[model samples]
Target chain A: MNIILVGLNHKTAPVEIREKFSFPEASIGTFLTQLVTSPLISEGLILSTCNRVEIYAITENAPECFDYLSRFIYENQKYHDNISFDQLTRHLYFYSSTDAVSHIFRVSSSLDSMVVGETQISGQIKEAFDYAMINKATGVILNKLFKKAISVAKRIRSQTKISENSVSVSYAAVGLAKKIFGDLTGKTVLLVGAGEMAELAARNLVNNGVKNVLVTNRNYQRAVELAREFNGISVKFDEIGVELAEADIVICSTGAPYYVINSDMVENAVGRRKNRPIFLVDISVPRNIDPKINTLGNVFLYDIDDLQAVVEANLKERQKEAEKAELIIAEEVETMDRWLKSLNVVPTIIAIREKVEAIRKSEVDKTISKWQRELSEEEVGAIENLSQNIINKILHFPLSALKAEAHLSGGSEVIETTRKLFDLAEEKQPSQDPEAPPAGTAESPEEPISRSRDSRENQ
Target chain B: MEILLYKLPLLFYFAGTVVYLLFFSIKKDSLSNIALGVTGIGFLFHTFILILRTVESGHLPLSNLSGALSFFSWGMILTYLVLEYWYRIHILGSFILPLAFLSLLSAAAFPNEIRSLQPDLNSSWFGIHTTLTVLGAVAFTIAFVAGMMYLIQEKLLKSKRFNRLYYKLPSLDLLDHLNQWSISVGFPLLTLGILAGALWAGDVWGAYWVWDPQRIFTSVTWLFYLGMIHGRLTVGWRGRKAAYLAIIGFMGVVFTFFIVNLLVEGPHRFI
Candidate 1:
């Protein structure tokens, strides 16, 4: 069988095209059920997220499976009249076997994400795999492939610093606060304005374990509204200096024309607070906090430009780490590719031998039953032995060739050609044997293709 | 056998220091653990050497400069291991192990031949004094390392330069806390050590007070740590000011340990 992937991502399609193809989370089970019912696909999984939608499937013919899956994706979304099949095909990309395995690994590791080192994509991929598993849409091949992809993603996360730094402005501010305060457990944060950025920073701080939040704005009603959202108390804007003396962290994003927090004001606050360190993040267009405040001892101040600079610098660091992640993904892909090739080779070899052996046994029985006179038991045994010897002699060279080809690179093509020469494809319809145990799971060299009902039921 | 024990630890300590430095640059988890394991082995060998020396001399191994230096290195490693276990500060080894390795290296320069203790100089006070003083020095060394870490982390935050080291180093708050813990603990041990030395002096020289350079320098080092402890407790001096005091107080310790022993003549120099 062949493993194939067909999908369109943010790079290949715009948000409009991507959203059109996204499967609703609740209906994913129905979608996967319908997907695996197709004659071309034996095993299947669908990863549907806002940025991309991808389908991974196993089939006997890669070309036919890719066509069937792409068309299926189009039919699922045919209600959208704005786009046609031509437009979708222009955006869709396809990969088979090793390339397909490598693509899934990259996608799972977030190396192919819109934000290169994002942490959400791996979790999303895991959810999709779990959903497919619960829906009974994934057999051994897709199951093994998806499990390996998840592990590779986890390995990359631990081995490299890809997800170490914050990429957003609010998160960068929180990161700086952590570096200064060590732990935010009992620290107090003062929100100095009603700007959206300040609210985001405040929310991030609360999530990080900051216990008390003080919200103050020139418009007292807005301050009360924001404070209630944080489960904190509201203070008048005039009392900011008093709050600053008590606050370990302050986020200022007011739309004032001049500096709201001056050097003299911070200097006074520093003395009142016993020279304890305080962090200030001013994320306003027109500067709200005095730049001169940073020069004072035990005061840390970051304006909008500084926070953005931190975010950009962190993004660059993640890009550097992404190169290392790619190396890890490449090594894992090679390992998975080798196992897939072995799985293909072993099953085909078994199927071809079983086909020829069945033919030999039936022919010998027919000749015996057609006899006009009764034969001795020794005569019957001699005829069976003669047929078995002929079958072994004729099968030795081809079976030996198949076993030898299993050891070479790109050996699956040779195995496929051998299967076709013996007409082995039509013998075992993949979905017809719904109770057949998955092949090559144990990876035992001796009993590679043997299956029992117990094994299938256990799976 | 004693010589073999002494020399084996030097190589192990050198290896440990190299690995720690490599871990500092690479920031790999496995490398740090390997470094810790190497350093722990070195500490074991060092403990054996000190025990053997004490057995041969029939007293604590603090009578000569070589023995004193070896004991100091052993104490530093012990303190480092304890702090590492408690704080999980893996990078602290990168700063602390080099000093330990250098102490052992310099100890090799002094004569290590064991001699019977002098009757006039020998007393139970000698052992107590030396042990307390060396333990105090170990604490100061840790304080010094923590101070340096605090300054670097502080500078990175103030300048907004989030480099690799910036991410690797712990927060200023943690480094400051380490500084406080070390200095506060070191001050009392140092005071007791000085008191024990005076008691030993009274029994040996018939005078509790001495004008010797070693005595004067030890008192000076003791005063430096006293100021550090007093400043932190009363005035709430912390962060940058506290880190500066820890660094400066440790310099006083180094002067008392090295300068008085080598250049200045004193009764305490028994090598």
Candidate 2:
């Protein structure tokens, strides 16, 4: 069996095309059920997010699987009239076998994300896998592939510093506030304007557990609307000084050509604050708060450029850490590849062991029956145990050599040679009984080996 | 055996200092915990030595340079551990543990032979004065470390170039707060120590005020910290200015504690 992935990410396709292929969460179950109906696809999953749409599958025929999936996506979106098959194929990128496994690993690890080290893509992939599992659209191969991918992503997150620091402007603003106040639990935030940037900063702060939000804008109705969204209070823009005194943090983002908050106003507010520190975030283009306010006691004012500088610094740090994360992913991919190859030799090893055991059992029975003197059951048992130990010791070296060679490149050649030398294939068919275990029984040593081989031949 | 016990603290502290410096260079946070554990063990051994010395001499062992340095190093480690527990600033150990180690190593350079307590140093006031003064010096040492951190962080912020070291260092606000706290706590203890010394002087030397260089310089150091505290409270002096004052005040502490004892001959020269 082979692993295959066909999808278009932010790098390959524009948002317009990506959106056309996205599967809504409510419809993903039905979509996955429809996808695995083809005989080529044994298991499947679909990851749909704003930045990318991916389909991961375990299949017998990788080329046919790729064609069917791309056609499926094109038709499911009802785009036959708007786009041609060749155009849709141009937008989709396909990977087969180990490359497909590596692609999913990088995607779940966020190394393939548009943001490089984003955390949201891992969760989205997990949700997609869980949905596939619930709909019975996934089986053994896809299950192991996703589990390994998730663990690789987890290792990358913990062992590297890629996701430790904030890399966004709004997050940096919140980080500065945390450094100043230590804890923002009961602090009040006063929003000076209703701009998008100011709302984003307020939202970040609120998420950090700042419960009291005071909104003040030139437009009173907009202020009330913004305040109502956060379940906060609305104040007048004219009363900025009063609110500034009451707030531990003030977010200023207005379109005023001049400074909305000057040094003198901050000086007075600082006096009233009784030495408590205040954080001021000025996210305006023309600069709403005076830069001189930073020099005042008990007041920390950061302008847009300063916030951007912090974000840039953090991004550089993450980039340095990404190099290390890549090394870790490379090692994990090698390990997973070795494990997948090692699965191929299990049936041969078990077949050889069973063949040797059968020969030893028949020879021991003939020796016991042909003995001249009538021997006791204990003497026969000792002879049988002695013969079994010799057979095991004789088979140990070749068995270990075969298992070791299975992990190297061109390992299937060794397995084929061993099967032919032992004539194990002819022996395997005649020994099969109606009462024997199923093909992929968990208790049997040859289950996954035979199952995987059957799927490969079925292609 | 006693000499070996005295030297063991120096060895442990040196090891801790090496580990801490390695941590600083490598940016590995786990090394900091190992450094803290090593330093804590060194501190326990130093405490054991002090207790042994005090039991052997029938007095607090603050009468010689070796005793004073050991006690001073112990006080600094105690203060550092407390601050580390409260602030959770692991990187501070990288800067402070070497000072602690060097102090103990210097103490080892002096003879470990216990001398008889001098007559003038036998008073209860002598013990109180020396112990309190050493604690005050430890606080100033902490302030010095925090001040150094503040300056580095300030430089990074001003230049807008943040390296790995910049992230490892504590924030400016936290460093400044530590500086202020150390000064606020150190100043009062130092003032009381000086008052106790004056009373002890009057009893031993038949003079409440003396023109001895040690006496004069201790008073100078006391007055400087007093001015710092007054400025901080009244004029809202903080951040860069406060950091500078804390650093300068530690210099005063070192001068009064070490230089005066060695160079200046006065009634307080029992060591």
Candidate 3:
């Protein structure tokens, strides 16, 4: 059997095309059932997200399965859009065997994501796999493949910093605040003006457990509206200095061309606050906070460009880590390939023959050694010939029948029966049962995935 | 010879320090754990050497400059291990492991001969004085490390120059907390160690008060940290000011440990 993936992602297809082909979660079970109905496909899974729609399958004939799935999805999309089959097929990308396995692993690891380090794709992949599992659309091969994909994704996450850095400018501001304050709890965030970027950052801070949010704007009504939205009090513009002293974080984005928060003002605030550290982010285009305020002890100031620079640097760091993640995925794909290769009839047949040959040799030697009188050379040779002939005669019909059955699609069931009949499981395969679900990925799947997704969304 | 046993830990410390510095630059989590494991092994070997020396000499191994420096490093690593276990602050090891290694290296440069203890040094009060004082120095070393991290992180934030260290270093709040904790713990140990040393002087030299350079410098270091504690508690002198004071207090420790011990002759001199 071979693994195959057929899909179109945000990179390969436009959103309109992707959306037309994308399967809704509620109807994916019917699609998966339709997917497994093909004679070539033994197992199937459909991963449908806003960014991409992919169909993964285990099949005996990869080329036939690929063609069948393309037509299947094309037919499914015909009901939704008037797009021609050629137009849809032009955007589709297909991977077969090892490439297919590697593709899914990379997809699950988020290396193939729109945002390369995004964590959403992994959960969506798991949800897709779980849906296929509950619908019984997946069998042993796809089960092992998806579980390994999940485990590989987990491994990559633990081993690399791909998902550790924030990519968005507003989230980067939150990340910087964390590096300064360690924890945002009980820290007060003061917004100098009710700008979009400043409001987004304040929302992030509040989500991260920043207890108090104070908004002060040149327009007092706007300040009160923004403060009410944050469940915080609005400070008068004249009290900005006093509020700055109380706030551990200050986000400034007023439209004033000159420095609204000057060095002297920050110095006085620092003195009043008794040298407690404060983080200031100025997301204004023309700059609001004094650059020299950064020179004062315990004060950190970053303007809009500075925040963008931070986001870019973090993206660059993630790109570097993505290379390491690729190496890890390569290693896991090789392991999975070995496991897949072992499922073939050739290896199991050789293993069974080896087991029987060893047993026959040991038993014949034991019987020969039991003689009280030493046998002649001819007699020993005759005994060896008899034992070999007898075993060959016994194994001939079964081995030939196994080989004959290997050409048919029902070969896996026969192979499994032969292994059990011969007890070939004792011969040290990579895994005893690839069908068994991985313990680490099985337990608490929904809680951790949703919780992590929630946290990332908050950021 | 005991020299081989003493030098073995030096090599391990050098390896540990190199690994920690690599971890600092590479920012790999496994490398930090490996660095900790390497340093832990070095600490164990150093402990064995000290225990062997103590058994061989029938006293604590702080009677000579060589033994005292080695003991100082052991205490520092022990304290660092405790802090790391509690906080998992791997970046601190990058700063601290080099200091610990250099102390052992300098200890190896001195004579390895375990001489018979001087009459004045042959007392339990001498042991208590040395242990407490070395431990206090260890706490100051940690404070010094946290302070350096605080300044580096602050510089990174102020200049808007992002680097791996910027992300790896603990937050200013956490580093400042570490600084506060170390100073708080170090000051009292140092005071008690100084008192014990005075008491030992009274027993040996018939005077509790001496104008020894080591004693005067240690008193000055103690006063600096005491003032820091006072300022932080009373007026909230924290963050950069506390970081600077911690760094300065460690320099005082270095001056007393190296300069006063080498330059001046006093009752406290054991080298």
Cα TM-score per model: 0.86, 0.80, 0.84
Pick the DockQ winner: 3
True contacts kept of each: 0.61, 0.10, 0.93
For each model, chain A TM-score? Answer: 0.82, 0.78, 0.76
Encode model 3's per-residue lDDT on A1-459: one tens digit a residue. 567778878777777788788898888888888788877677999999998888888765555566787888787783555789777777778776667888899999999887878999889988999999988999988999999999999999998989998999998988899889999999999999999989999998899989999999999999999999999999999899888899999999999998888888888888888888888999887988878878788888888888899998898889989999999999998788666655666777788789999998998789789962688878888989998898899989898888776545445566767888987653422233443212111111121111111212221
DockQ of each: 0.64, 0.30, 0.69
Question: In candidate 1, what are the lDDT values of residues A1-459, reduced to their tens digit?
Answer: 667778888887778788888889999999999999988878999999998888999876555667788887887783677888877777788777667888999999898888877889989999999999999999988999999998999999999889888889988988898888889998999999989889998888899999999999999999999999999999999888878999999999888898989998899888877768999999987989989999898899999888988898888888888888899988998888777767767777678778888998888889888882687888989998988898889988988887777656646556756877998754444443433212322222222121111222321
Clashing pairs in 3: none
Q: lDDT for each of the candidates?
A: 0.84, 0.80, 0.83
DockQ of 3: 0.69
B1-271: candidate 1 lDDT, tens digit per residue: 6467679989999999999999888745578889999999999988987887788888878888887888889988999999899878888999989999999898898987887777888888999999898888888988999999999989988898877678778888899889999888888898899899899999898899978888888888887777777777777688888888889888988988888788877777767
Q: List the lowest-lDDT window of 10 residues for candidate 2 chain A.
A: A450-459
Q: Is candidate 1 or candidate 3 better by TM-score?
A: 1
